[model samples]
Target: MPTQVIQAQPSTNAFSGFIQFWKDVKAVAQPYWYPNDSGDRAFSDVIRSWGMLFLLVLLIIALVSANLFNSFITRYLLDIIIEEKNPSKFSDTLVLFGLALVLVTLLSGFSKLLRKKIALDWYQWLNNKILSKYLNSRAYYKINFQSNIDNPDQRLSQEIEPIASNALSLSANLLEKILEMAGFLIILWSISQSVALILVTYTVIGNLIAVFLTQELNKINREELEAKADYTYCLTHLRTHAESVAFFRGEKQESNIIDRRFSNLIKNAKRKIDWEKNNEIFNRGYQAVIQIFPYIVFGPLQIKGEIDFGEISQASICCYFFANALGDLINEFGNSGRFSSYVERLSEFSDALKSVTKQPENVSTIKTVEENHLAFESVTLQTPNYEQVIVENLSLSVQPGEGLLIVGPSGRGKSSLLRAIAGLWNAGTGRLVRPPLEEVLFLPQRPYIILGTLREQLLYPNTNRQITDAELKDFLQQVNLQNLLSRVDGFDTEVPWENILSVGEQQRLAFARLLVTRPSFTILDEATSALDLKNEGSLYQQLQETKTTFISVGHRESLFDYHQWVLELSQDSSWQLVTVQDYRNKNTSITKTTGNTQLKIDSFLKDKFQTKLENSIGEGLSHKEMNALTSYSLSTIRSKASKGESITTNDGFIYRYNKDPKVLKWVMD
Candidate 1:
């Protein structure tokens, strides 16, 4: 069977980056709210952890009520002592009230400590839940590339801590206020009916004002969040690419751009800060006026013989509770606005992520097609920025063990075609029958190398695949990279793979990976562009020996000879699969791998290397000899050299020796 090529029409990706991120957060949070779910379980675990505080609330309430009763007795005894001169009774009453005060103070202190302890644990639980989701879902990648979720690191690390702490404290405070209002409102109503009416009016008016204030605060907060994200993004971007700027000598240019971004952020942030400062000023004044309100309303009534001492004391407690509850309204309302904005942002982000792929109604199981054979019928592909087709479906066939090269001017969707085949670019309509995705390897122009040891670089995506340490070293030698093997400890050694390897070295590493994994087919999209001609030709020649089906996208003319056929993308929105009859003529003497002149080939390569440095021994090694050295079977030459042993091939190629001229020539060269 032959490989088929189809020209595809592009489709736009409509998913909003911000909306998708919110969806992911909700998908993570919703199940936690479920009673038996892990999230719910974690929340429940919080209750147990704070059980002491929960119990203390009951004790605190009892102590407070008892202390309020003692206040009534103390007030009555003082009145009797002043009016009737009953000194002994007043003294005993004073002693009893003092005892009640001591006990109440002790319990209140203990409960406050317990509350603090519980609050810390709740904060930790919420933090863990949010951070876990960010780390696990490859959400970091989605946030960076697919979503407009600006500065997720800031969102997770800084924004989350405040959200969690404030949410828990506000919830607990609200519950306590509700209990106080319920218990005391009834007592105040009985003692001073007129005052109760006034209290209710004040409560209603205060809450309305607080609600209005909070709505305005939300507008300010939303702007603040956006500005903060922008500032954080600039800082993070600056730090991440600091090394790049330093290496390129472009620090001033980068610094100026960052300064502009920061200035914009600061301009917006000042507005938020001014709004917050004004609101807080008003809130503090309102809170101060509310503090002494209890004494003002009920004191005159008690003096005029309107109510008994017990009734007066009860009215005072109720008035205080009512006034404080009104004050609480402002704080809770402000917090609710902040929380709502966060939720809305989260919800919108989720919506976008869910729409990443038009939920496949029935995803057909993908199968790996046989070598050099691809079948795509009615294929179309699209990108977000363009309405035109990236590629439109048409057909061509390629036989097994054959190479098909794609060449075109830039932005022709040559690389995109490979991505679509890999299932990374899903914004397309097509029946793309490919070999099992795992059976093929796609190497991009700049391959991503994760931070890890050399072995890790080689065994990527198949980390658990059984590969020996010795096998890894041999692979490195085949790519003429034996020097790196010593610096690396093992496959598990952690290092920044991208920084340690040069662009060309990284491509060679990718090729080294090809030899180890041995996929049935390989796609190279400017994979060798970073390498010089010699290394590039060497990589292609190595690919030839494996008889692996090759689909390449490059403008390099040297690559044309390796393939039996070439697929040229045309400006007319079509492709040409032309057979090259003159392929043999294009082949250079150096590239011809096997011939009767094997020894002659070695001498020729030796001569080529001599021209670079006259003092160098065996400077030019023939391409065939180089190929023989890189092949898997003769990899022992590298291991032998590392072990300080003299070794040579029977075909007159001495790999590691100092004494013999031929051996010294191979070693020094």
Candidate 2:
């Protein structure tokens, strides 16, 4: 068969892309202008509560008045110097000029101070608002785990400050320039209409060219930001996985990865610099032309005596200020591009937070009740992707003070079922009835070692509760962690607990927390995987002593002694539930054979005792199987044969079992 090639559609032209970019910019800015509940209150609150509008009006008035007064003084000084012809009049002119200069300076300084204060206030308010939403809504988790939004940490930590500061500064400066332009345009037009016309035409054309030249600047900035974030993420990843990398001696590999990320960052940064450089060239030329163009236009009139030296000088000053103010868009084009990029990122982050925080409408949630029971009714469990059904139509319940053990092969959704019961996973149609969130606690295999003092670690997830040192000490003793107090310099000492404590020690500490809190219900997902049998038995005994109910997902046969019931999950979303004793009886039944044949019952026994064999597989055989297979005593053989398979021939009966030779020999001895 001939191969067929498919081509991608061509990209949009610059004009269409530019239009789309502006549309996106407007969409990002719309929330700031017309905010909803999810939007930050800082912008609206600052404008309303801080008298920002009033301040802005005052600032504009002060700036325009100051510039007008300065222009008047310039004209007055020139006129007096040229026509005075008297030393006494010159001294008076000098004194008047000094007073006007001081007044203009004061007004300008006061206006600048007000602008700075407003900007600072907005910065602080917006930062607090963004942080409040980011944390209070739990957007951090959604962004990190559930959403495709990148670098929320950077967006929240780094981008927010600049957004607040630059947005305010740019808006204030732009407003002031507009006011200044209005004041100067009047002065320039009065001096010479031709100069004013030329100034307006030049500024308009220059800004138009700048807009087209820097149209792609925002896209470049966004790419640069992403590259920088990627590089930072790589460095952070290396630090987080430092132990794994060290064990594998992957320093060179990690360095190569870092170098690749840095290279990408540098490439994007170079593009940004080059774009800005080209932009700066255009702005600088436009600025230089604004300076000299007025003189060139009016120099002929000055030489012809139609306009005096003072008139030319005054026109030049007014024309320069007016043209510069009009050219604000051209001069600050790069900053505007950067600001737009910041706004786009922050706006997207805000939108993501809003979407994540908003409760899904018309979606069923695992309804939690105030009762002391956990129940699942016709629950169908599936992965988050909904690609595979893990458990189907499963119904079970555990009352207060009763324990349930969930057992299944690996990847059989054992842990996912626990998550659903805990209200973390809700991808399928199911009704889960559990105690209120506050009354339940979940302890996974690897206990979470929070960064804090030992006392704080015990009191975590419940930090506000006040407990005496004696009570904390007693709880530590209950979990066999009393030595932790002295080893870590008492409860108040702060250390990196995850690094300082062994995994077994951490698991014990987590159990200590359980004892201290005494939650109404607890869910343990292999929570005892790090502890030995003795320690595990002690912890379970402690739980049995309490009125707290728990459901455990484990593969330890010893755990069977603690749980009253077993919930076995099988393939094809099938499951079975039976009392612990009944399950043991079914698996321990013996099969008798009458013919002269070798019976193979390992496959059947393996399925029944797989959970126990996983941890107790001594040299590829279970401890019980080793003893039964190697025993020489007829009594032991009969007892072991009762729980396994046997064959009887015409001459005699033969017994055989699978186990390790060493353990079998030891049992025989």
Candidate 3:
């Protein structure tokens, strides 16, 4: 027996498809036409205020009337030339024809000018409204950081103008087409109802086919946008990390990554082009058929003497324009596809902005209040994803005229705690009582070097101050950045400060800004890490001289001298707070007791091994130093010492050289 064959049937529900297509179009268009805010409704506002709607209606009426009059004159002239053959009437007909032509041309030019003006006005208004909303809600940060939305910058900068301009232009064109179709339908039906019926049927069928062909275009367009954004992001990443890539000599690796992104973009673009090409081919064939169909229907009438040459010409013109007007969907399928994609992007971005600005319901946020002291009450901190807890029910406080230094191992939420204090991260429940925002200043480790003049840098986050040149220079001198002005050609000169200034210099400049502002509370998250001991001590001394109370996050023991209290964060989401003096006293006792034991161990090692103990241990002495000496953790060191794989002195320090004589020989050699 032969194998049975089955072929899939195409969807025959053209009516339902047509309805869905219209519904999709309406969904894209409704937001701009009828906006949530009356002020932002560009179309309605512009039409009402600019009198453009009235002008448009009048222009359409005049244009249609003039075309009818022109048609009438052509028919009359033909009748006279063919039937009456009067030369005198021919001159009169020519003059009437010239005048009608002139009137129509003037009306058409004026209408186009008016339409352009209205479209431009609407574009400007809508662009401003959308831009304001985007910036006001700080959606740029949310979209860039939190949301998966792609190419917000492109949507705002590139897509908005075209969306606004095309929306108004398409609406006007559609309205004009409607009027033209209505006016010409009468002429075609009077000539022959068969021509009118043929035109309508042809338009309906062509539009249905176009809609079906372009049904998946919106999905393809969105993919194209994503591919473009991906390629753009790749380029931006390369630019941002250019220095690192250059140092690593990884140009080939970066090139491969960029090539992959470009390849993906090309694939999507080719797919879009293929679909567009197919749509265009169909539209071109449809247009060719429209051109010849009228002549085929009306030629018989002219030959039979039922109509004159003028009647045939008028009927063809009327039928063609009427059919063209009704076949808008077929002609504008490509544009509609792109327009729908643009609408979806813009609407999604707008909604994302709204979502970012609105506070999440039923989620507990850190409640901040103004007070003289900076305190965290019953604070519980977690990652933004809530995957791990950082600080659990911790309470700490730092009063005026005091500084609190927060110390923790890496990944113990030291920076996150600072972010919580700065109000940037609000992932867990807490009551953080602190001074008002204006009264507090935060300086992160990597100082944000904005693009501006040196003066602007000093006055950042408060640009409307009345500080004199002398005062600004004094503050710069205090932070030891007095030479910055001379290097950058004084305060008013602008340069790329991030590139021009070293990291340490930028950090000091940040301190200079803090000194200038002199807020009641200052939070520093390893802000002095880039500075040497001298500069760091000087900056902290200046802070002490000022009225600004500060909370610092650092690992250096020197930081304890400047801070009044110490808050040490542990790995188990617990923290211990102690007075800085008490912590220093405890450490001092331990150090004194450990110092004698270390001396005894050093003497014994030197006497027995004939090696300099200082050279073996190197410069620094701490848990880190011990790890470097033993290549193991404190727990590993303790375990190995118990098993004689390492040796521990009375100071609780491990030496790997005792168990492995080869290690000591290698070090001494």
Candidate 4:
């Protein structure tokens, strides 16, 4: 898959952007709050959620009202100080203010707690809902073909909680601030109408500017999200392919890739910080200027004996609060931009999943039928996209207790046929008759070692099937993993099985699963590739004893002894099925016996290099001769020599002794 550095553009129309953001919020929120038939949603859960929200709103109202009461109390205390100047009345008024303060604090705390509780519940439900859809109908597997959807794991693990939490925070903040604004504005109106009207004009202008700034912020937040995902995916890719990178000594190249990704992330972060710097200046400046408006309006009135200092102070306090509320709204508008980005991303992910879950109506797909055995009837297979035909009208079947080995040159669609049997691909014209998937087990080239305890590893895909530890050890011993228990504590010990087990050991352990499962039909795609002849033979012998019909994709000549039929595919989308003995006789080039071990046709090509490159008289081999005899192409040979693997003379020759090349394989004892 190609790497995608997706950048989102700012919405051109600010009003339309807000309208879309609101619709997106409803789309995201509906699944959780309004009960849907999905397993993740419940009517009872919805009711409980609404009840919590209802209580939260009541607390917010109480807190807002108490704050309004406190502002009025501050005005009353000021009037007593500047006008009455009675110490006993002032002390009593202070007690009332203190009581109101305690009530507001209590309301504020509970309101916050309830908001968090609701968001926490929302996070769990949304995560579960998305996860179910992601895993359903093999959407997780099919989604990989989509390059547009990047870093799904990052989206699932990191992006989900923020959606839940931020939604609540943005909504509650907007609600509380709006209510406070209305109350303070009412206070301003009662004290002085002119000042309140001027403040309202200032608020409208501030909001217009906020909408434009926030739209820009929305673009930045989206870019930042993708940048972070890209950088995270880069690190994860390095970790997954660490062994391959180490073998190639690709640290410099890998580091360059990581640095590039990280730099992109840093660039987005810096851009956001810059936008925030400008946004803060606007927000603070708007509030700072509002601080003097009330004093300016009423200062001349006090000189004319129309009002006292207490009235001026009260009007100023109300004006300050009203502007502060508007300032908070501007900040929330910025956060709403980030909120918009989250909602947009998750909506895209969910829509993609729903789409891929359904089959394409217009496209022709191979029909599947579940039967007692395996067979392909007049099957013409194509790639998933129907880009190329793999085989034309191919027909074959395996008997109830027989083995069929698929052999072909590399890239001849051998494994692609197994995929058809597994029902992973079906974009073609044919009828694929096979046993129920539950009764068929597929072992790929690299066996999947699931994360679990030693016992769980052995009994994967059916861990609930009870089996004695002693019997499991017997199965392990059958696969030549007898000392595995000694290395670990026992069957219950859980380690990183993939890291701890060698490729050969992991393959053996995969075969050990066959013994445990004993499925009626089995498909092996180079399942024993990592195992030596001894272990391969032992496992194949065990498989034969199970009396299960199996189809294997293997190039080994020795594998012919284990199977009755050979299915050979050609690069030109042609195939021929014949008896194993006849196949061996007809294609002598494919099967070569090297001592007791059989070398694959490609390996036989490499084995000849031992004799061909032999420096019998201590004479160097020319580049042409080395390139002709070795498995690697001339381009590959030149690349390796250029990288200091070999020192060649100006004449393009490498000197060596006996049958050994100048470069020797380093074996760690």
lDDT of each: 0.63, 0.73, 0.74, 0.81
Question: How many collisions per candidate?
Answer: 40, 0, 0, 0
Candidate 2's residue-wise lDDT over 281-384, tens digit each? 88788778887776787778878877766677777788778767766645565576567667667666766676666656655444444566889888887654
Off by over 4 Å in 4: 1-24, 36-40, 146-148, 203-286, 299-310, 589-669
Candidates arranged by lDDT, highest first? 4, 3, 2, 1
Q: Each model's TM-score, in the order given?
A: 0.62, 0.75, 0.73, 0.79
Writing each residue's lDDT as its tens digit, candidate 4 over 53-172 gives: 999999999998998888778888988997889999999999999999999888989999999999999999899989999999887877775336877897899888999999899889
Candidate 1, number of clashes: 40
Off by over 4 Å in 2: 1-50, 82-155, 158-163, 212-223, 263-284, 298-306, 331-367, 381-388, 426-431, 449-452, 477-505, 532-534, 585-669
Q: How many times do residue backbones clash in model 2?
A: 0
Which window of ten consecutive residues has the lowest lDDT sum in model 1?
1-10
User: Who is ahead in lDDT, 2 or 3?
Assistant: 3
What lDDT would candidate 3 get against the real structure? 0.74
Prediction 2 global C-alpha lDDT: 0.73
Off by over 4 Å in 3: 1-163, 212-227, 256-284, 330-366, 381-389, 425-430, 468-474, 477-502, 584-669
C-alpha root-mean-square deviation, each candidate: 11.1, 8.6, 10.3, 10.1
